[model samples]
Target: MELQLGVLGVGHLSTAILQGVFEHGVLDPGSVLLADRDPDRLEDFAGLGCPVVPSTELVRAPRILCAVRPQDFPAAAAELAPLGSEHLVISVMAGLGSDSIRSSLGGACRVVRTMPNAGAVLGCSMTAVARGPGATDDDDAFVERLFGAIGLTVEIDERMLSAATAVSGSGPGWVYLLASAMHDAAVAVGFDSQLADTKVRQTILAAARTLETSGQPFDQLIEGIASKGGTTEAGLRVMRENGFVEAVVAGITAARDRGDALGAADQ
Candidate 1:
């Protein structure tokens, strides 16, 4: 069968995307083509029956997913510059814009820029997508449906993509850091390592489920758990005193700024 989808890189995020697509029946494995510089990585995907092709051949597919690293984009774009206007190019590369991609690829192909978190590995990613100038409504829907198989997707203005990158693309690391802290605290309190890990994981999961289902304001959810003079409230008071909220805001801002810097370099 002819390849319908082409992936430009075979890194962790690319593997997650392929896994989600295959596991969820989004596309047939045989119809997917993969290209990467590393033969080992290509072999890994080849073992799963995906055809390994040269990067130069990626343009043959009607839909192409660019998962290459920011530093590697110039080379990949050179390979894809020959793609015709019929190609729909979707890029998951952080800090790179659709405009940059379009310019690099001869300004002809339809392009979409997306930020999908590590949750894609578990089919729970929070993805934000923005279309380039050449993209049409059909292109938008096609990209959205392709990503929707892996997780929730939101459409946003390209201008806000950096902020989305900070919040959604970089957000998983923040959550994981909090989980690690909670687990460490549990262990310090004399809990066994296994119990600490399980408790912290379940606590985070339950809290996330509640937030998802409650439809309440975040403050309201917090108030529900941290009543005045309660243990939760006491802990929150310490966190507030220690500027936890400020720290989190600063971290997000830094990530956004870094994204802008990366985009600037590409421009």
Candidate 2:
């Protein structure tokens, strides 16, 4: 919701981010500034009504958002080093660390490290943010407002970011995977492709709503639909026999560990 928004990379994620900010009414097109070395990106931004400048100039804005690749972070930080103490930085890069940024930008400048999934483009994202070690409550609050504009905002420890990245940061893909599977299953069960697609979407939505509002235990909720000799129970037994629950647990754990590995790989 900050008017003085400066973005470092005008790539795919940056475009989605700017679009989300506008669609969510968090920012106006005229108020957002962007910078990137890529001419194609600048041209695209121009069409979107965003002011695209050189990367160095973007850093001069009061609040800068870094969306560049991890390898480009150091260079971007160097460009932002000239900014005054009043500047605040928000980074959504996967592998970059807040400490590296705070050390790069001088004085008591504010730093925010945030991880939001690609779903932010649709204003339905779960964003995790961690402020600088020295950032006051006000600093963190402002960041909460910013990220909340895109979706949900949860303030958590930077160390926990690896796990957060696995869950919220990569949650959209997991959801899509299930959606795809459900659609395919519907089609295999004699439903037309279009019907399967439509029904699967509604099914997913209804199931999510039940999970959201139902006070009953998850096991009880599932059991409510599945009779003692029903098809659902048969499927459930197959899943259990195949270690479905364990596989899911292992998958998320692997994702969390992969995130930690990516962040630390640079060091």
Steric collisions counted per model: 0, 0
Candidate 2 lDDT by residue in tens digits, 1-267:
445778888887777777666666766776778888878877865776777777778765678888888888878778778666677888888877777677766655677788888767766678888876466777677667667776788888888888999988887777888789889989999999999999989988999889768999999999999999999999999979989789778888999999888878755
Per-residue lDDT tens digits of candidate 1, residues 1-267? 877889999999998888888777878888889999888887866877888899898877898999988888898889878677899899998888888788898888889888899889888999999988788998888787778888999999988889998898889799999999999999999999999999999999999899778999999999988888999999999989999999999999999888888888878
What is the RMSD of candidate 1? 2.4
Could you say which candidate leads in TM-score?
1
Q: What's model 2's lDDT at 106?
A: 65
Error of 1 at 130 (Å): 0.7
List lDDT for all candidates, in order.
0.88, 0.79
Candidate with the greatest lDDT versus the true structure: 1
